[model samples]
Target: MVSKSRSEWSTILSHLVLAAVSLHAAVTSAQSSRGAAAGFLLQTFAAITMLVPGLNTHEDCLAGAWVATVIGLPLLAFDFHWVNGDRSSANLLLGGGMVLAVAGDHLGPEGCSVAGQAVLLVVSVTILIVAVFTANTYGIWGGAMLGVAGLLSRLEEDRLLLLPKEDVCRWALTAGSWAYCRALHTQRLQWE
Candidate 1:
């Protein structure tokens, strides 16, 4: 029993490692096409493998994970299909989130004053709606890269830096970053 328990943990730990490594590679490669391609590939595999963990044991948490994945995954497949011009649901959650995030890409700390902040708040909240539904590495990685690029392009002392004026828009990216780190470090780290 003891060894069996250890083996199960080892399995879980392995998944965590792979998730982490993939996330790291994906995030680090955000600036280059080769990196982006590779990252996406890794993320694709990670999601596929993640789907099977619930089978090893039947627990409520695993069941919930499965349900969450099912609820969130179809849009990615659909989107990827459209991108390849194939029009299938192969990457559904990925597809839908991309559409939303791409549209919301413009809301950044730009000429933002009090009025601007109000507009940004509305936009960020809209973006967050899509972001919340995304549970995969693709959504997290994409958002992280977008946020990073947005921050760099804006390139200002006051705007780029998080400070007292911070609000949800300021930390809107925290979810993606948080998910990226956790996926890479905890789940993807162990992937073979």
Candidate 2:
């Protein structure tokens, strides 16, 4: 049996916490923004999958997580714009990007493809731009962190200090998810 490093253990624990936070955000946001809630729910599932031993190393599991993220990000972006009454071109872009992502997922390889990665990057950057323009603090931080996570994921074979790039990526993703859930929770409170 291979021994796991401290960084890996931390990453796993963080994901578990992320799952719970995402679930709570989903439930709280459901009444106000179904789209955002759905996105959060999907993310919750993705995070929970990390808890299964050795599952994260599976290609299918990785693909499923990517699928969740690709679809979830667009839903979150679309819902944020809609709730704020900013029915601009951003919403159209988000919708189109989501559809493209879904189609790409179905047509691409069993694991994540380059085309899928490109779509995810584009969608993430677009959301960041939207958040910046709309002055959403939580979204701004979340999008930025997720963007970093996405970039880091591409460097999975690399290592920093004693930790692998994947561990750093997971940490960034967890922070991003936490911020996103906070954004959703705050929005829900606003509607109350």
Q: lDDT, candidate 1, residue 127?
A: 29
lDDT of 1 by residue, 18-129 (tens): 4454455556544432323343344434433543645434343333322222222233223323323444333434444345334332433232222222322332232233
Residue-by-residue lDDT tens digits, candidate 2, 1-192: 999888778777767777787788788778777887887788788887777767666775666576666677667767766766667754775666567666764665634455545655665676677667766678788778778877776764777556767667667767876776676556555646
TM-score of each: 0.26, 0.75
Per-residue lDDT value at 192 in model 2: 61
RMSD in Å for model 1 = 18.0
TM-score of 1: 0.26
Q: Name the lDDT of candidate 1.
A: 0.37
